[model samples]
Target chain A: MSPSPPQLSPKELSAYFAFTEVSSLLRHSVEKQLKDAGQLSYVQFQLLARLGDAPGGSQRMTDLADGVVYSRSGLTYQVQLLEQRGLVTRAPSPEDERSTIATITDDGRGVLATVFPGHIATVKDLLFDSLTADDIEGLERVLTQVSAHLRANPPRSAGSRKKS
Target chain B: MSPSPPQLSPKELSAYFAFTEVSSLLRHSVEKQLKDAGQLSYVQFQLLARLGDAPGGSQRMTDLADGVVYSRSGLTYQVQLLEQRGLVTRAPSPEDERSTIATITDDGRGVLATVFPGHIATVKDLLFDSLTADDIEGLERVLTQVSAHLRANPPRSAGSRKKS
Candidate 1:
């Protein structure tokens, strides 16, 4: 006989999956929004915008990965692609030879300048415009709680637990 | 020039970019959890499992797509891949001739049965285990509120603002 499916109480279900749904929708909305101005993905736009603001338009790869929610390797791969496109360029970090630094090319900054206004507007509508003032404050507080807790208790065996 | 990148209020910055960090880590954790055994992506597992629970192991493609959070095109592509694997099949919908129905095969059920238990456990740990009871409740309420708000205030423009 097959094992019984573990049932989550409504509260538990709401607590766990509900927020993921919102976050996922937000990403989808963002992705769709980005597709309008140009071919750039949301992360690509973010990387360009960040680099445009950083000192000398450059930052270490590790910091960029953290800011963009990309895995280090995944970010490296994407950055290399952007570099090849002449959207950005990479150089050996002056601070650490072990690290690579990425900078937005003039072309990249120009693309971002073209794309960012509309992108930010979409973010406001899809996210901020939907929430009441109280809702925003409440959500910020809860998310902060979640962020702190997740940092303190990173998933351990959780990753491998779902494999057959 | 061009507003000097404007000083973003702290609240806006945190709300816009910060949660992406948590969502990224959570996705990494889920992906890592599901890589071995069958290498089933979360959407694939979700599609198979949802179909397994349907009458005749089938559901309309649009309904299934909404349930699993994929856009219609994305779900269609994924279902085609599953069909290639002989895990699912599609047919004309009887009640709605314009719609397509998706049906999971025995192999799909077998795969879901093998993977779902650990998936739920991992979800429970990756999420619930990291949150306090109050935090959980707070988050659920916040998400429910946000979800409803978004549905009510659908974006009229795809991407045109530059606030975030």
Candidate 2:
């Protein structure tokens, strides 16, 4: 194999390492809070929270999968788990007979209602508590730019999904 | 419930969402690169890279787990996989008979050498490409603070592991 290319600058390396460690730790903290509050995983809470925020408390499965950055098969499995627990329901879409739609149930909303406070608190403690208002604005601007670029040029693995 | 504890301010909410999306996308991008370049998962790459970076090219298992934000059992599994591939070896620590030390083999460094360029490129493309130097500084500062806090008060699930 060809020799490794030039190394990243110290600044770049430091920034990337810190960004990664923070992300992992934050996810761990949030996952624990969700589990303790409602026995929910992070992605499960994301799906429920997204549906709770939707226009009709529901979204097409494909849409939910894309919004949450999950594989369609993975989303289907989580939805099935939620459905079994009575927190969500899946049905044939009215607009497209071949498509399935996922809707949050009253139980789902109730779970969100129960878990959200702890979620918010966990986020604040692990993330926002250390950041100043200016830091928040700066992070928002930087991450928003990066996120749009990533969404436009998604990884090949995620590009096969039907776009919503 | 306490009415969802009032919504986060738009600025805070936007920042948090952007942060979450950016973190997820970056991981996906990096995972794809590692898989293609070295047939490595992100966590496996992390362990290898960490071992390569450590002084004397070795570290205790518990220290590795804590540094990587992984569960002790999970780290044991990954270390075993690497050992099976002859990339890393685990031996009784001379300093502490009860502890096992993981050391990178020459083959492990070879794999990291092969994949580091692609890893750096992927990180730059998905993250640093859009970020200004000022953004890098801000991110490093904010994330370092957050990581330090989270490491100090790690999630309950991960707290059971012996700290190194």
TM-score of 2: 0.92
Candidate 1 docks at the CAPRI level of: acceptable
For candidate 2, the docking band is medium
Per-prediction DockQ comes to 0.35, 0.62
In the range A3-51, model 1's lDDT, one tens digit per residue, is 5656556887876666677777777777776677757887787788789
lDDT of 1 at A97: 94
Q: Taking the true A–B contacts (Cα pairs closer than 8 Å), what share appears in each candidate?
A: 0.36, 0.62
Interface RMSD, prediction 1:
3.8
Candidate 1 chain B lowest-lDDT run of ten = B1-10
lDDT of 2 by residue, B1-164 (tens): 45446456678788889889999988888888899899898999999999999998999998998788777899999999999999999999987899999999999999998898988888887888877888888877877777787777767655764665
The number of the candidate with the highest lDDT is: 2
After superposition, the stretches of candidate 1 with alpha carbons farther than 4 Å from their true spots are: A1-7, A66-73, A84-87, A95-98, A105-110, A152-164, B1-9, B52-56, B69-73, B84-86, B96-98, B105-107, B152-164
| Model 1 lDDT, full chain set | 0.74
Tens-place lDDT per residue, model 2, A1-164, is 34556466787888888889889888887888899899999999999999999988999999999898877899999999999999999999988999998999999999998999888877877787777888888877888888888888878654655763
* Clash list (residue pairs), candidate 2: none
Best by DockQ: 2
Q: How many clashes does each candidate structure show, in the order listed? A: 5, 0
